[model samples]
Target: MSANIENFPGTPLSQADFDEGKILTTHWKPKLEYGWDAGVAISRYLAELKNGRLIGIKCNRCRRTVVPPRVVCEWCWEPMEAWVYLEDTGTVNTFSICYIRWDATRAKEPQIPAVIEIDGASRGAGILHLLDEVNADDVTIGMKVQAVWKPAEERSGSITDIKYFRPT
Candidate 1:
């Protein structure tokens, strides 16, 4: 939708007034949703995490397991048919050391968000997480890591189920 002042209701607001509205909305709530497919997978994953397991679904056609599980094969476009247990340990596919914190949800310390290629999964298939217990200078592609989970009482159905990753 267009945000032009001329299309706004009633009198046109000045640039300063429009800027004021933008500033106010800067902290507005983010959009949230729970579609049918996502809900089922999330419920299952969370239950598995509570039992100290990392769960993912495997595509019947491609024989590739996907973490945070997908309802279908991303590569072959076929329904994922089986459940698989993934090793928390994986090689870092790509990573970035951030000197600046982009979101308040992260730790006060600088974080390195990485795309980790989990063991036994298809090439390039990966999960993103913050890398911990290492200095920024030591961070490198292909570094192995293991998931550090949150306390059982603090577990949730989201990525936050794992607190972070540490050197393996």
Candidate 2:
């Protein structure tokens, strides 16, 4: 049997031709910046992180503890006010193995990121953070983990304050 391969869309260029600049191409990088207000809850949350502590808010209506504390509870549409300290340790709720870097470059080793359900927070509440100091293949749901915070002086009231989570 014969195949018809000519009814394609646009022109196709070989890797060598593209790499050699045989094809006309223009690219430009955009300078972008972003600013965010942590607001009452999150600002306090990040601030506590800088002080080597974790905190959460409770939704009085649903009685669910919220992590990365928010100003309002989405569950009951009620204003969240009760604040509580959370444990640095938690369980991995879910995860991903990143084979590419943020810049889209191939990575030699995978980056493991997971939503860790903090021990003192609601059962399903978690914050997304990276994992390190362990092989990627060893990561598993429900795996116990703990935050590895940066040095106190290096903290800047940001999520990155906790460098990463590692198996406990």
Candidate 3:
């Protein structure tokens, strides 16, 4: 194979003055296992998802519903003991159209990620998920949105299992 320098024309690229280029192994690590169970709350959340329910736990003391199902309330610092069905509707608390790799596993294309305050939950209590079915130009700070869940059988015990949210 030959090296074509069209993109970086006239730029000094290290070709080693050789017939062809070679790939390098800069670093390597052994595959390993690492995980947290997230326990009953998340487990129950997954189960609820199977039933087409968006479940968040509410703090009985503060009455604030926390998405991602925390076992404790972020406000009153009390134990969260009630399961609440989020309305699947929400207002965008704030958002950004990220034009970079959101994570090591995300697609090369940029994604619109937002913190959404789902209905029936207190302000500032929200979930982080991707926004779809809307253009980056259309996304705004106060936009209303709703969840679009994957088929029940396709849901995993993870956020992506919800697919993405879109304008309501």
Please tell me which predicted candidate would have the highest lDDT against the true structure: 2
Q: Whole-model lDDT for model 1 versus the true structure? A: 0.79
Q: What is model 2's C-alpha RMSD?
A: 3.6
Rank list by lDDT = 2, 3, 1
Report the C-alpha lDDT of model 2 over 49-159, residue by residue, as the tens digit: 999999999988999998989989998999999999999999999999999988999999888989999999989999999999989888999999999999999999889
Model 1, 101-140: lDDT tens digits are 5553545667789998888676778988889888988988
Worst 10 residues of 1 by lDDT: 19-28
Q: Extract clashing residue pairs from model 3.
A: none
lDDT of 3 by residue, 1-168 (tens): 247544654645466733354544356798998897868788888777777777888887777777778787767878888888888889998888886673556566678889998888777888889899998898998899988988878876567777888998
> Candidate 1 has what TM-score?
0.71
The 10 consecutive residues of candidate 2 with the worst lDDT sum are 1-10
Best by the TM-score measure: 2
- For TM-score, candidate 1 versus 2, the one ahead is 2
Question: How are the candidates ranked when ordered by TM-score, highest leading?
Answer: 2, 3, 1
Candidate 2: count the clashes. Answer: 0
Cα distance off (Å), candidate 3, residue 3? 48
Each prediction's TM-score versus the true structure:
0.71, 0.82, 0.75
Against the hidden true structure, what lDDT does model 3 obtain? Answer: 0.80
Local distance difference test, per candidate? 0.79, 0.92, 0.80
